[model samples]
Target: MHSTRPFLRDLSDSRRKGWEDGLRDGYAEGYFRGQAKVIVERTKTSFPVRKIKVLYVSSGKGFPYSPIDEAIVETLKTLTASVITAETKEPIQKLAEKNRPDLVLALDGMDRPVEQIDAVRALGIKTAIWLTDDPYYTDMTKKIAPHYDYVFTLERNCIEVYRGLGCRNVYYLPFAAYVSHYRPTLTRSAINRKISFIGSAYWNRVEFLRPIIGGLMEKGLKINGLWWDRLPEYKQYPGGIEIGKWMGPIETSEVYSGTKIVINLHRSPFDETVNNNTAKIGALSPNPRTFEISASGTLQLVDSREDLSSFYKPGVEIETFSNSDELMEKVNYYLSHEKERQQIALRALERTFRDHTYNHRLNQLFGYIFK
Candidate 1:
């Protein structure tokens, strides 16, 4: 009655600003404090004087569309005192001899020539190769793995395989997410979809998705990602969104966050019909998307894998489906029950931050190597 609406509006605006400012200040303070702690630790341990010099050989040029390769290089830079990246175009022998790095880390050795690895190893520098595609590159990888000081595989079972290939220092280092890059920070008014799946349209995926896409659309599911350019059917998925172009890791994370459930479908690396050389390794491991989606605090509906239970408690931290029927049933059930879905997502986020991160893997590697 006394025209108090203006006062209420002003109060609301001030409150909004206060919350935003608080979040900004808090983030800045935490970041600096973390840096300060690291510096103090380094000084106490004399780590800077004895800093680990690392040479990171990246596969970015070979896999330009995927951001994970670049992310790995950036993460290594943070973990080491000095990191020199040797791209495919660079002269590896000269760079390694000049830098004389304490360690050389190569990601996916198939993209790199064996001669380059041999050249770097010739400088008496320790070399390690982290293979993302295990048995898929089994033939090529086994040929080059023995040249490295350490052989790290994403598939746990492949440790024996590498050892069988005569690599003595083989280790199991699975794919992980960078927590700082992936988090549930973004907020939205309304969810654009009840479920979502983002990935390239491999022949297996296209075949599996054809019948279910329409049903999923009826239930408000969205699908968007790079599909095979040659397949006109993938170009025009009925009712499903076609991203057309490649999306970076950040964009993928945003899409994961906006959905109620993010589906995790592993691609067949050996589908010869598609002319894709990815081998059907029958590897029992989860890919980077598993950790990335969980770290984003989104409920994930993943396919059943043997190693999944070791990482997360099925029906608790994640939901798994063995077939399309199971997937559809869970999707419908989870959509109707919001609390269960959110709880699983929360548990997964906690697990990811605690165990599944790039920092954790790097620390383990360095500790084992330097010990």
Candidate 2:
């Protein structure tokens, strides 16, 4: 009877453990199903006029935190889209299936792996890939071009490249600023001698600026950015120049307003020829810095590109330079001719207000999508 009692107790414990495990599994399954039902129900509602549900996938690298996330969300709100962001491809696909959004926007060049492309495509949703960087070095176009409904490139040369690659739909959408965020303040004050450039250090930019440092210094230019740290100790020059670490988007815009002239130099790694389909020598692409600096109502001296004339009337809206000599000359000319500099800045502001807002881009995007 004693032995039988021990065996009976063991059997009872095993049965109790099995029942608890079953309960836990049932709870998990129920929770997932409930969550999925909510997502599906939310997606089923009728979208108001001009409202598109956009699923934007980002690697969540630089601006994944709350502040940046909030800004991106706010920008998307202007489009009246229910914006959802995900970091991984699997979750994004799952969301895409559950939500069945009208459109999917991928932030970087390559947001999904090759394996998941079929899953996303299977959803029968329109996919747009936003290329922030040059696509030449990456296999984004080669691997995923066939799956995308449309490809929007910041580089103009990419239109032809993607078309050649059998992407029937390709558009050249240059980088733009949120006009509401980056705009001229009503009060204009005297300019101090602060000059800044904001971007990561790249080999091409470092090499290009090396020979021109002396010219810039001779003209009393105060240069700042990440390039200072990358310079050799012996070659590095010191003086009134201020070097800044990475600045957030808001801080960067504030810096633009405080400075007298903001110089925008494209890094070699991102230059048009390297990543664009245009002939290496003839390739021209304007980075977002052009629009951001101009929108802030700050005087800008940008590296000259042939395509820039298409966007803004050269010598009227903004000034450009080809080499170090040309850059220094423009810097001096603009500084001495303050009225002309202000005029160009104002023209840039006007042009951007009329044609280059994110709203404008969204309109164009939707037009193409519906067409």
Candidate 3:
């Protein structure tokens, strides 16, 4: 025998080790499976089948498109609601009269007529209006919002303003992304841009971007939006740089997917050129782009806002910048650390799909009002 005792001992030890490892791995796999099952059950329970007839009033497609309006309507459809859409005041009345829906929802009601609202309420159906830009259009909104049965506002801080206007059923409804319109890409886009910004060239944005323009361009920066090209101040960029036009929702998602870092500069309601009044300047909540960029599966670098943490965990899910210098510093750092950037982007995308989709928002609305 070739040392039979030693050979037997070695074989026993190896088998013991293998069994322990297998046990550990099997336990982990079983635990994760249980967790996943729980999550699926929770999701199934959250979305109960709800059927209601709704008449939707929107600005419709053209210049200054409202993707959020489209998203809300689409999400309602998934809830088994029969929806009839109207662009303007005239069609809204005609549709409401023909359909006799159980409820009427007017989205972005700054352009809606008070007479039309009265006409819909005359049908003995409940009327609701969701304002995308709350304090920005409060002067007109305060005049009309009190007439509706329910009022939903994107500006959380302005809930009291509607209440002050003697509206009883005001609710805080935040902005969200349409998951289908914005998502991650498996393959990289054909474009070569590294960092991108897509927003209107408001005064604060123009001024904030001026300082870091040269440095960001050296590291590859691309910007696209309305009025960005028309601005003379931004013309000083390097020869290859040019401000591009506004993109549609899907094209905007494509730009975000192609970039490494998507910089989001929120509009100041005080910027009269943009918001017409500075009343809600202190209100610092994120705009729709904040969720859209995260949903696009790109690392988002946004300006510091008070309510950002309620949506994303800064420095973990997304990065925030208070000034141009900080933004430039982070841009360089994140670009060099590819693994960390990708991890954050992945986490953000997961969060967006789990909590910030339009489907989730619509469910919240229905749960609150319908209950």
The sequence of per-residue lDDT tens digits that candidate 1 reaches over residues 146-233 is 9888998988767887788788898888878875566654434134567888887777777776667667777877777675443455
Error of model 2, residue 302, in angstroms: 1.2
Best by lDDT: 3
List TM-score per model, in order: 0.80, 0.75, 0.84
Evaluate all candidate structures by whole-model CA lDDT and list the values in order: 0.74, 0.65, 0.77
Q: What ranking emerges by lDDT with the best candidate at the front? A: 3, 1, 2
Compare candidates 1 and 2 on lDDT and give the better one.
Answer: 1
Cα shift from native, residue 328, model 3 (Å): 1.0
Q: What global local distance difference test value does model 1 have? A: 0.74
lDDT of 2 by residue, 1-371 (tens): 35445554666777867766777745743443343234323322122246678777664545423333344456666665488776653566788898888887766635467455557778798788766665444444556666687888777766777788788898888767775566654433233444566675566666766776766666655555555666553244576345555666666666676565788887653455446423342347887788878776667888887688878887888888888778777887886775677667766766776677666666677778876
- Clashing residue pairs in candidate 3 (N, C-alpha, C atoms within 3 angstroms): 270-278
**Which residue pairs in candidate 2 have backbone atoms (N, alpha carbon, C) closer than 3 angstroms, thus clashing?**
none
Q: Lowest summed-lDDT stretch of 10 residues in model 3?
A: 36-45
Q: Report, for all candidates in order, the number of backbone clashes.
A: 5, 0, 1
Model 1 residue 126 lDDT? 86
